[model samples]
Target: MLDLARIIADELAVKPTQVENALTLFAEGATIPFVARYRKERTGSLDETQLRHISERYDYLTELEDRKKVILETIAQAGKLTEELQAKIEACQQKNELEDLYLPYKPKRRTRATIARERGLEPLADWIKQLNLSKASAALTPEAARYLDPEKGVETVEDALKGAADILAEEIAERTESRAYLRDYFLKQGVFASRIKDDYPEGTTKYEMYRQFSVPVREIAPHNLLALFRGEKEGIINLTLDFDETEVLNYLESREIRTKVPEIRNFYRELIQDGFKRLMQNSLTSEVRSLKKEWADIESIETFEANLRELLLSAPAGMKPTLAIDPGFRTGCKVSVLDETGQFLEYQTIFPHTGDRQKVEAAKTISRLIAQYKIESIAIGNGTAGRETDRFIGDVLKTCDNPPIKVMVNESGASIYSASEVARDEFPDLDLTVRGAISIGRRLQDPLAELVKIDPKSIGVGQYQHDVDQKLLKKKLDDTVESCVNYVGVDLNTASKELLGFVSGLTPTIAKNIIAYRNENGAFKRRKQLLKVAKLGPKTFEQAAGFLRIRGGDNPLDNTAVHPESYAVVEAIAGDLGIPLTEIAKAGDRLKSVQLQKYTSDRVGLPTLRDILKELEKPGRDPRAEFKYATFKEGINEISDLRPGMELEGIVTNVTNFGAFVDIGVHQDGLVHISQLADRFVNDPKEIVKVGQVVKVRVLDVNEQLKRIGLSMRSRDRA
Candidate 1:
């Protein structure tokens, strides 16, 4: 285990102690968030990503050990378990390396060598391995072929020698040492090369991207490699690894030959070259290339997940009543009003095209709702009738002598969310249209909280999400959600079950039970009160209690991310300093004197203690800072009104692998392609923007017919 920890530390470029500490915490059931946030000092302040990598590597090493055990047992059963072989197996660090060592002894179906062995030619194969080139010419005599059988396909002395050579070739191919040497040589020196098959139809553009491409194994870009392999799998191209055959043959022959006999050297060279070219080269090349591609895909997906998590946790617009409108022509407009806490308050249908009187009535209805609810903002869905509805609402706000209610365009995934089972349960009595409006309003109020209720794919925030591996995408999306939810602590008192379900270590069942208990008993006034909920056991509490916040709890530390189990420790520190926890919250200057090392334990180390001190400095402080207002053009209501180089305020509606979709007071949300994400190269669109981010953009192109408006943030810098 210590050696495994050292290997992991070497791979990750960290101290062995850090890997051991992280593994210990992980083994003790501490989650990534808990270990990352609370055990910083032990791990040298490793972030969540680094800790996850260590955990994953630890699992891989454990699997490697298991494979080693299996290989040793198999070899012992075969009566071939030598001490040298056992030591080699134990020293293997990777799954691939262990498998390579076990390949020769692995059970298999009858092959050419197996057939020869069954034919009683094992003696001849052994003689060939010792290959006496001094008498090579004499050994090929007819009497030397007495064991050869014509029916078994060995016709003469020459045929027998050829058959024995074939057996030798197969044996060499299976040798663990030979395979390892070849694998390492290929990894360090091989080059990937591809070309369109000449036999393919002439002038075909299907494989144009890969018509001629070459890159060393180490230098190939992951995305390009994935694209090339995908094209090849789709039959649009062909790929191969390029290597110097003569050089490889020399390397293999050098290992097999020790004497300076000219005949022996020539024979060995011919044998090794034939074996590699005919049996091993192509197969090994393909296998290695596939493995490299898999590694690249894993890295790419990890990067994508990181970028997505950051985007999902971006700053929200905060809780405030918002007038949501899903505009449409034939069905009129769906409007809803939400209270300051994002609850559905009222709903109304507004039609602007029926006539001027209908338009006036719709305007009056909107004005009344805005006045009645004191709506802080208006959120318009960026769809077919969105521009018309925005214009109508703007005109109404202008005519009224009320506070200027900012009109913001929202993404159109709320309809999908509203029709979902989750939305139905939340608003059972409300119509789908009204629920959709409520979703829009809540999204504008706090995107992170509301968006969590909807499936990320349905939210239309990803590029090629439907085309990617569904299981992989879902796992990544779930991880992103958990990371986001944990990053912004959940309010235990007021958070909905949907939001609570995403909190770290809390399952959907526990989240539902917590809500049920709150409904039956009343609002929880302290962190300890969670224990009263059914199935809210000690283990779950240990994991989740820290992230669940109670704003006005009996103990101020309960409002922070400090766990209840650590209350005694905090009290001790406070007592030693001669101050109360509440007083420390008010003025944390005295906390500087509390020595964290004195409170360290096997479970709660100096790392966790320091975190507690930091939390006490500002209890219940929001990770997201203050919100800022976004400014939109006064009269612009449609994409047609947009001109090149004109700056406009836009809300990011959907973020995808390629780019982000922004609504600029236009009925259609324009795409800001990933290439135009910034002046520098943007690998993912989510890195630079996210869903519901209010960004300033400049119009690059406006297509009225197609309703496509090209937007850019690059010019926003100049403005």
Candidate 2:
């Protein structure tokens, strides 16, 4: 077997030592985020992406080695493992290659070839393969006559020859070289052709775009391929891989036929064609399709991860007294008032859309709540009746002496959160709608914190999220959430268990323990308080201390990302500057001139010292962008209200490979196709836009009947 670390290092373009160190850290129970952030010096400052690549590659290589061992053991038990064969199996780099070499010896279940071998035809097949026909046109029946035995199920020479042909066909199909060549050909030269079923009329099913689609396997987009597979799976379309059969047959014959004898050549030709059509084509087609599907899943999952990361890392509106509203039509709007810390302070029902008298009462209630809570921000859920509710609030605010900043929050997964058990645990007596309102307000305050409680898929920022590999998707999404949560350190005193659970090295049990400790005692006054939590040992503390913040703590550095182990370094710096440790954040000028190399030790290198100095500059500073919101057009409340050539400011709700979907205050979002995403060529939609980005787009067309809105952002297409 190849050196796993060396192979991974070559693949990732990093040093083998870095890969080995990262693997060692992983084996020691360190996470990707922890290793990437804290063990920079040991791994030569490898980032999260490179570390994850190394980790994933290590797992795959380990599994491959285990599979190779099983295959070698099986072959050895069967007395078929030769020196050359053992060498080949040991040197195999891919699982497919190992399986290909093992195909001829793999156990079978009553194949036609197996029946022939059992019926005393194996000797006859061997005779024909070695026969050198002196007469080019000699009939093969004479030679096959010796194998004709009634007791062994071969009744005549013809039956014996047919059985021999079956054996040769299976043998030809199982040839490792032929399989490798054909698999590569199928992937590179095959074309995916899909057509709608006769039962589904043209442009009727949701898969109309794929009704008569044909694309080369290599050039098909990931989303398009996934769509075609889904259509075929749903029985609405017939999908097949089309390739040049004559070319494949020619290649197989050239590889197998080595004689000038026409009779033997003809016999082998017939069996080769039979092997390809009867045995190899279907299996190889499925294998190619499976490979393409895996690739598509990876690309789709990556797109989902990018969008999810952008959504999770979106700017927060900061902690402020907030008024949250879950907009509805007949059910009325559920109103929730939250304090600056996102605690639910009050709840009410306001029927702003009912009668004129009810509207007056709703206006008065909102104004009274604003005055009572001193609401600094108003968060309105962008759901049913959202625009109208925003307009109503706008009217209400017009009369107020000091109006708060009213922003429409995309409450995509608010319903999911409201109905979740976590929400129930937090607010058992509150109505679901009331809980939803609270979620909207909290999301505005801190998106990462609130969104972590809900499933990332339910956040509605992905493409074909439900169709991807659920286990793999969950892992990627969880990793994304964990990375974001740690990137923006969590508040030790007030973070919920869901948010705290994502902290580096913090398990759900430990998060719950931290919450329990805070509840039994008061808020954490120092970062060291976490050591008291049940099951949170020193190792956990070492990994998690830097990413957990405690504001107004006994030590000010606890509020920043500087780890406790590095506290001595900062204290040394403060001592050198002749200043107290509390004033470290204020000594930016002096600290900047201080050589970072002077503070570096064996464990604390330049990379870590620089990070510490940066953290001291902006203690507990958020890495996300500043707060911003799209100002949707006032009158465009529904799809019907939209018109061509109307320029509107919208927020990107989701970014897929094809385009960006922008929410322009209408209930439905409009598509800004990849071609229209920019004036120049845009290879990826993410290159131009991301989730939660406010963009300006002009409406190109609107199909109200289908609820489709076409939009463009190219500067050349200005109205």
Candidate 3:
């Protein structure tokens, strides 16, 4: 077998030792984030993305090796495994290659080739296969006539030749080289062509653009491919692959037909065409399509991953006293107030949009709640009646001396979170709308903490998320969430179970245990106290302690990202400076000027040392950006009010491959195509905008009936 470590190292462009050490750490139950962050010395300081590639490639290679073993055993038992064949099978690096090599030997149901082989036609087939230009003129009639056997169904010269052709055709189709060539050609040269189905008229369905689409298989965008596949699956489009059949047949004939003799050359030509069309075309086409689908799934998943990361790491409004409103017209708005720690303090229902009398009372209730809670911010859900409610709140704040900072929150998945089991468990006595209100408020307070409670798919920041491979999508989204959660360290004292579960090396069960222990034993005072939690041993602590923050704890280092294993080094650094541990944060320039190389040892390196120093510089500081929000234009509250060339401020709600969707205070998000994102050409919309970014855009066009508002961020006048 090929050396797995060497193969992975070569593929990742790293040393074998690095791959080996990382694998060993992974084998001992270490995670990607932990290995990437903590074990820099052992793994040559490979980052998380590199470490993940190594791990995934290793697993795939191992699976391929196991399959090779199975194929070798099966062929050897069948008495057809020759030394050359064994070598070929063992050298295969892909599943498709191995399967192609084994197709001739694999057991299957009865077919035309099987019946022909059972007759006395094997000798004739072998003779025909060995026919070269030297023997091109040799008469095949005499050799094929000997295979006539009435008992076995070959009753004439033609019957015998037909059976021989069947066997040779199957043999040609099963050739590994032929299948590989066709597979490559199908992927590189074929065209993905589609048209509207008979039942679905043009421009009637969402996939009208794809009705007459034809793109090179290699050049098709991942999003476009996924859309075409979805259209085909929904029976709205008739999709097919277009390629040069004559060219393919010529290539196959060149491999088999080596003679200029018309009889022999023409004979092999007919057989090659029959073999390809009958045995290879459909099968290879499907395989190529599946391979393309996998590629598309990967690209789509990565897009989702990037978007989810930005959304998860969105800047928080900080822990502030907040009033959250889930706005509605007929049902009124459900209001909830939360303290600085995001604990629900009060709830009420207000109807400020129905009547003048109710509006006055509702305004009074809101004002009283703000005064009672000393609210520092107001979070209004961007839903039905959201703009009207924001206007109403602006009016109410006009009379106040110090009004709270009011912002619109994109409440994409708030309702999903409200009705979730996690939500129900937290607020059993409260209504779903009230729970939703609290979520909106908490989202403003800390987006990472509040948004973690809902499924990422429900967040609605992906393109064709539902159409992608569900398993791959879930894994990628989960990994993204975990990465974001760990990137911004969690608060050990106040983090909910859902947020805590994404911590390095912490499972859902262990997260629940930590919360249980915290609830029962009061707040954790030190990072070391986590060892006492049930099912949380030393290893879990080692993996999770660095990412878990305990603010205002007994030890100041506990609040930073310094791992517990490195506390000794920190203490020694403080001792060298003759300052107490509590004053470590105060020694600003001294800490930076300290020689990082002097502290290097077997367990620590410059990377780890630099990280420790940086963490010490900003202990317990958030890695997210400063809080900012977009203020919607007051009068432009509906799509009907939108006009082309009007400039407006908005927040980006979602970013896709082709464009970004901006919530421009019209209750309908507008599309800013990639071409209009900036003055220069843009390859990706993500490079220009993110999920929570505030962008200034000009309305390029508006369709009030269709609720489509085209927007542009270019500096020039709208096109």
Candidate 4:
């Protein structure tokens, strides 16, 4: 049926040829990052996001095709598959539509219709269904009597008519068009009504707002539906749909009953009402609710993915000798010191929040540790007593001659990482909080590297992450992580096994093997040495080598993003320049003299050559932006310290379907609603802001009772 490539192209607003070539490349096993970066010409310069969309849609269509094959095969085997029915099924573009087309032919258990049919009443029902349209008042009484047989359990005309009505109801409900029209009617015109269950207290819970609530079925926001569904599932509310049935009944009557005969028309009315109520209402309500929930899940998952991507791509403070603290109040703050390369050097505890007496001792201990480790930066986990700890550190640093830059780091999944097997292996003797502190320190040094150790779901950036489709959520988040990792090429000499797992074509086993080989034989001197890693064969090397950077390797090209397959071309240019590969780094101007066209071949094209030349010019450049952070306002340590019109500098901790949550050093994050995100209209907050973005937000309002703070970035002057 459909031209899949052309349909996808139209949806994405890309050329059909680009879609076709990208699909072909995908079928041939090329990864999205590879195709987006290396095959620009083939895809008409489609970027990574576009390529990902194409890939996702391609997978969906492929799965849909497989489903179609299964449906057709099963129907054909059932011996009821017709040419027209096959065409109808083939023409369906959606899973719901395809299933609807297969509904009549699907296997059935013993139901009312089946029981009636087995009792030899099919002819009588057919007679009723075909009542003469021209003459209206045709009596179904005589026809019902003919079907009454004592042997078949049709003991009377009334029993016969009842069975006939059940058969008719099932028939009407099974019609594809009937289901389609009614589903649309419900979606557009129906209302979702939820009332507090009888005998339930009014103010007992957060669901009080939904005690007597009604919203348009089509207009209910994702968050509202999720809350409502939770409420219904918890048995606190009685949820149901309300819609005008007159319109639907009229539509069904016009389609199913053509005859105007008064007697038969009366019976048809009863049949239609029974079908709508008994056969269709429950299933259709479930179907409609499921459809809406799917849309909401999609919205929530996309929000999660976007927030996670921003958090993962957050600016790193670079490799600096640092001290990190996972702050606490009563048990004392866990302190971890790390060297420039993130090697754990020491661990201790300091009672910064104990009192004025212990606070002085804590400051002394921090100063000694800083001096001993020569800490270039201090990272404090933004958890319990985080602001108070920061204040203490700032006061202590004020008394020092050479103070390090102290920063607060989001420790969202630091605990998860600390308790993980990876952490246990690395710091077997240390306490969990100490491992968590080390993770926080490493996170500031290189966020992408440290964040990969924890599952994206536990990263605390997702909204309703636990409630979304786990399989779809995992696939999407995995793709996002892989894309981010490859975009930031890993340093071959210093990358941990966990960091390398996301590299293209590299699995966990291969990652571990590479690290093992590194420890045994030292750093990889060139890209070719990757082949020596056990089980990292030619294909794996081909996919992963370009994304792995080996600084100061034997070949200078090894450090850049240029693939190994194109090393010959790079060497040729270096030879033409009459310089060694190491010296080729400074030979950008001299290399312009060579003809790039001469380098193009069947295997390597102009797009790839252009990338090679670009890499040669700025070899080993980082694609990530320069490191930066938000400076939270002083003295705003808790929600109680907040007030309206107080402008503060904060980092966005999470972005959602409705708004972005900004942490203003107040412990609790404030919501920057979509309407207040920008001066202009803002529908998607991701377009205007991202996680970890340092923003100037003015406080719009604060509800101390609810622990809610509303923030605005629209046309407000920064304080």
What's the candidate order when arranged by decreasing lDDT?
3, 2, 4, 1
TM-score of 1: 0.83
Error of 4 at 106 (Å): 0.9
> Candidate 2 residues 434-472, lDDT tens each?
999999999999999999999999999888877778899
Model 1 stretches with alpha carbons more than 4 Å out: 12-18, 39-46, 132-144, 157-159, 177-217, 232-274, 353-358, 383-392, 400-416, 429-433, 457-476, 569-584, 588-610, 625-719
**Tens-place lDDT digits, model 4, residues 1-719:** 67889889999998999999999988877888888877777898899899988888888887888899999999999998999999998877788888888888888898898999999888888878767344545677887898888998999999999899989889999999999999999999999999988768878877998999999999988888888888888889889988888998998888888777777788888989989889888888899999998998989888988888888888789899999999999999999999998999988899988888998899999999989989889999998889988898999999888999999999999999999999998899999999999999999999999999999998899987876789989988999899999988999889989989999889999999999999999988999999999999887888888999988877788899999888998888788779988788798677667688988887788888888888888888877788887777788899999889888999999988789999899888899998889888877888999898999999999999889999999886432
Error of 1 at 209 (Å): 3.6
User: Which segments of candidate 4 are over 4 A away from where they belong?
Assistant: 1-10, 13-21, 132-137, 577-579, 588-595, 716-719
**TM-score of model 4 (CA atoms):** 0.95
The residue pairs in collision within model 3 are: none
Candidate 2 vs. truth: CA RMSD?
Answer: 1.5
For 1-719, candidate 3 gives per-residue lDDT tens digits of: 78899988988889999999999999999999999899999999999899989888888989999999998999999999999999898888888999999999999899888899899688888887777446557777888888888999989998988888889899999999999999999999999999988898766899889878999999989899999999888888889998999999989998888877777787788888999999999999999999999999998888888888998999999899999999999899999999999999999899999999999999999999989989899999999999999999999999788999999998989999999999999999999999999999999999999999999999989999998999989988998889899999999999999999999999999999999999999999999999999999999998999999988999999899999889999999999999999999889999989998989998989999999999989888999999999989979999999988899999999898889999999899999999999998899888889999999999999998778889999986435
Determine which window of 10 residues in candidate 4 has minimal summed lDDT. Answer: 129-138
lDDT of 1 by residue, 309-396 (tens): 6455655667777888877787888888877777777788999867899998998888888788887788877667766676777778
